[model samples]
Target: MKRRLVRKLLFGAAFICLLSTQAFAQDGYRMWLSYDLIENPDKLSEYREMINYVSIPLSSPTLEAAGEELTPGLSGLLGEDIATTNQMQNGTIVVGTPGTSDLIAGLSLDDELNQLGPEGYFIEHRVVDGNHLMIIASNEEIGVLYGVFAFLRQLQTLQDLEGLSLKSSPKVEFRVVNHWDNLDRLVERGYAGLSLWDWGSLPHYEDPRYVDYARINASVGINATAINNVNADPKILTDQFLTKVAALADVFRPYGIQTFLSVSFNSPVDIGGLETADPLNPDVADWWESKVDEIYEKIPDFGGFLVKADSEGQPGPHGYGRTHAEGANMLADALAPHDGIVFWRAFVYDPAQTDRFREAYDEFVPLDGQFADNVILQVKNGPIDFQPREPFSPLFGAMEETNTMIELQVTQEYFGFDLHLAYMGPLFTEALTSDTYAKGEGSTVARVVDGSLFGYEHTGMAGVINPGSDRNWTGHPFVQSSWYSFGRLAWDHTLTAEEIAEEWIQMTYSTDEEFIEPVKEMMMMSRDAGVNYRMPIGLTHLYAQGHHYGPAPWTADLPRPDWTAVYYHKADENGVGFDRTATGSNAVDQYQEPVASRFRDLNRISDDYLLWFHHVSWDYEMNTGRPLWNELVHKYYSGVEQVREMQNLWNRTEGLIGSQRFEEVKSLLEIQERDAIHWRNACILYFQSVNNLPIPNGYEAPDHTLDYYKALEHTKYVPDPWYN
Candidate 1:
């Protein structure tokens, strides 16, 4: 009967509403580094015995931080304080670089240690003089810090430390979180209350949140973060704010998270009192160089500029009829002296009539190999914006000589804000694993961004962070998985969505298989479920204008045609879907070989991408034997059903996980149900008005008239900051 109850609860998400009670409310600022004590007696004892003593340097800031974290982390997990030792003894955990610890230098691990680059680590258990020892050694101090965190993670997840032999390293060079936070504390496209920076109190008041924030990021292998929005403000570079930014840098230095800024391209004109901010202008270049010198003085280890040049209304070299290479190269020259990088954003679109997906490629591919060595073009995962589903950006493999990185959005600006639990792990993995077919069939976007395919030096994966001042960090409990997913993937792109979700589950929630099994399944399916209910099967960017919360398929009122739903959908009386084939925009031609050919042929295209590449008639036959209109409608309904499945599964985990978090997720799931229905009803009805098609017999009818749904009174709703 208990098994039967579990089955019903797991599948149906029954009693989801019961999770909303006050008894379940929790402040979620801890994030994934919850050093909760282990309940398993055997594993706890083994872990305690393995890490009886820690021997690390007392001076190096990075090593000091590693010791601080390890001491508390082991104490919390083992339920006792661990002893430190200078002498090599049994059960001694020696953690340091070769230069710091002579014991580590004499390990004869030269060959094994060489495989781990500057920031990789090697953990091994050895015995000398019958003394059981665990050595966490690395080539650099930062690598030892990472190894220490790995050791703590084992404790957090209750993994046996006995005979632990593990070697790990980040595949990418730079892993950063790009915060779209403004100076006034307003987070653009942010849904979780306010920005986490607390600019008003910063530079003076050292908020403890900054410390924990760094700790959490370091635990996940994230090494850098840009505190400001990519749509930057020139004032951030001013002397006053630079001092403030430096203060935050001092706090993060110990944890190895470098600070970066999103620079306004027109800084010379806005802040330097210059007439023209042209890249070619000597005075403008001098101003940037002088300012970078000031920044480095205030913060020596600064990660350089993240420029959103010529994109949106942001100023760039385009104003002077200069190429993106000319613009990026100018800044790269300035930052090169300081060993800094320029993350030039490739999310560009002009007012001209063209496919939005093709614009970034057209502008960037021509400038390949022209950029300075330090300049890396930061490309979004998809060709289009961060839609529910999109083909990999054509620019990934197209630019061989240029360095590149992937930028993923963790905030659900278009995925239902903080109200829905849409895990983004699957979405991230899907884009990373997409085969670009640039060098060959195996030349994937992951390889392109990781810098292996192009044989380039720099590589990175950035997440537009979702963390805010909300009690739960991200307003929804399950939404935390996206944050975890981004960090884990940025460290190593090879990890599966399911693996990350399961690891996050063990650390973030419960370790019990019962709780983990269903929750892991829910997180894995969340992205697909959201795509189903919102924009499934390559139907991209059809959300309500401005707010982007609900459906607005009929909207064509935006200033730019490309900004509206009608621009991308191109739905009419004939059929629904865009045409990007040779007859259409020829965006498919941007891809190499077999990929382009497969996308061009209707018979060969994946059904998930049919609407993306080709415009089909309503009566056109689908792979599933359904007509185009019927298939589209079926997909929308299938997405809604998937959400219901998520809700039921979430509701059933109430007793297994913490009551407060369980109920919190339950309430979010309830909100998701309504949002999913809104997406389904509004989209189906509006499309029905155009196609004049009947709803399949099994699906539910529209909840209200199209006008009723359209009349959603949106008051001061601005989804994207640039929308205004």
Candidate 2:
């Protein structure tokens, strides 16, 4: 009898060990699709019983990806092994194109599916033969694959499964991420870790990370990605590198993602054996067409090129006395036959121009209607390069006949990198919701890009991805919110920044109210706080030369005249701001008359953008009746105090979350506070020197001398990942 009891006890112990091992195996690498066993197992028992078997027909690459993803997700979430069959069986979850599955055909979904486009899906749960059946149907194989992921996401988020009727499609025609990665596996402005792409082993040995990267992007609505930096390397377009790119395209294809490359405009002369790359020359045009055809042969669904030309020393049509329209149209015509589109960058500025901010609008606005139907002008959120705050780019509504896409920087290049928790959702919303007054008061940047305002054939959005090979993906845990926000906004721009932040916090962190509330508050206020301390009153481009880390208000020795801080702020005894009004740069005239008139009036303009539009004196009275200098001082002090408050708020949540993540976040916040003070002090001191004014009474003096701030250099700083 004793021996029998020992055998039973040993068996029970082994079973418990198996269960524990299974439970602990899940890591968050799957992101929101972590389909772990439901906490309320009873609530999901019906789905477990109904989805015991899956039948998928027409084994295409995309259908295989759906099968590979769904089976594992279901096994983990429901704690049961779901059998796959070639034919429909009782309680089968059928997924495929209309003709591939009888269930889909019987429902007469082919016509409806055809209307949903290549990236759309329809999910329906109905009873067949007295047994419950869930069907994922689409006109194309890739759409079925997307449906499978969407169905799994619903389960992961604990949504209802019965009587489900859902049909979904992307509002924008193209959703892409532009990676500024170099051949050396370094990411430009990347703070996370080393680049995810392993260029050294490409073509010969493809990394599994490439497949994983596609999976993550597909989970969101992102359908296209440009693999290289805008600063093109002609070698990347060569036959040798084409093979490597083909390998990546193959991995991404199953996930419904296409690969794009940044091309050198002078590649015909630099990489090819041709004499010149003039767009109007027959030889040059023939060479480019042949090159594009060659690329398409290797990767059939390859997205077209992204060109950054005539800016920062890159070659362009300007080199051949042709307009940007002629240059982009040449490439666009080549890619048009293959259902591809070219994304030409509009971040151009000439140092010789008196007003750098007005250069892009001046150059491109005249050629608005000249671009090919398949070309899009990808403009930055602001006229300037990702400043803390600036007026919306005038280019948004200026082009009525051309397609446009808003390009946002997801990586925190200017906002303390990965150290400070600066959520960019607010920044994005600020630009999107700004009334351009092009068509009327309600004409927003979001409407302009969504093709609602201009009624263009194509519309899209691109975020400079912050993903790296870091263990946590993005370097700072909180920085992931920017990526999350970008995807959510791309899907539906109407969603508020607060709603997106809360959703991400709940999914990635804890769902408990105590943990969610304060963290959400921190994210909502973080962007404004960074702006207050760094570039309050719309002053910008004041970072140190290379690294762009801390403050450099005294930097004035750069090669170009506009490259220095003094050129932007223009702080002197006369005034302390850029004069873009009618009297100075006349940059405001680029906007529509109503918008220009509003900004031209000092009383009518918002304080956030006051200094950006007008040059105000130090002693001038603000709307608050305080002198301009005093208001600036007050904002800087207020910013430092807010950081301290954030630190305290974080301290209270120590034991509420995991100790490892909590400690990592706490350390980063401390670093941000220190840097905030440095920005406040350095900027205030420099401005005080220029204005010859007294420091506000309550504000603190500089901890170090102005000379000390100027002497500090970053020769050892990391090079931009794209440049590396």
The Cα local distance difference test for each model comes to 0.83, 0.81
What residue pairs are clashing in model 2? 187-721, 188-721, 188-722
Candidate 1, number of clashes: 5
lDDT of 2 by residue, 83-133 (tens): 987555666888888766765777777667867887788888888777677
Residue 68 of model 2, lDDT score: 66
Q: Which portions of model 1 miss their true places by more than 4 Å? A: 1-26, 713-724
Predicted structure with the largest lDDT when compared to the true one? 1
lDDT of 1 by residue, 1-724 (tens): 3532332243223112212223322346566766667767888778877778888886676887788777766776777778999868998988898899988887888987999999999998899778899889999988999998888777767776667799999989999999998887778888776778877776766666677678789888999999998888899999889989998898788788999999998889988999998899999889989999999999999999999988889888899889999999999999999999999999898979488888999999999999999998999998878888888899989999999999999998878788887889999999999998888889989999998999887899989985778766776666788998899899989999998888888887778878888888888778888888777666878787676778888888678989888887888889878899989999999999899999999899998888899888889999999988787788888877887898778777878756666777787787778778888888888889998889888887877999988896243333444345
Lowest-scoring 10 consecutive residues by lDDT in candidate 2? Answer: 18-27
Candidate 1, after superposition: displacement of residue 705 in Å?
A: 0.9
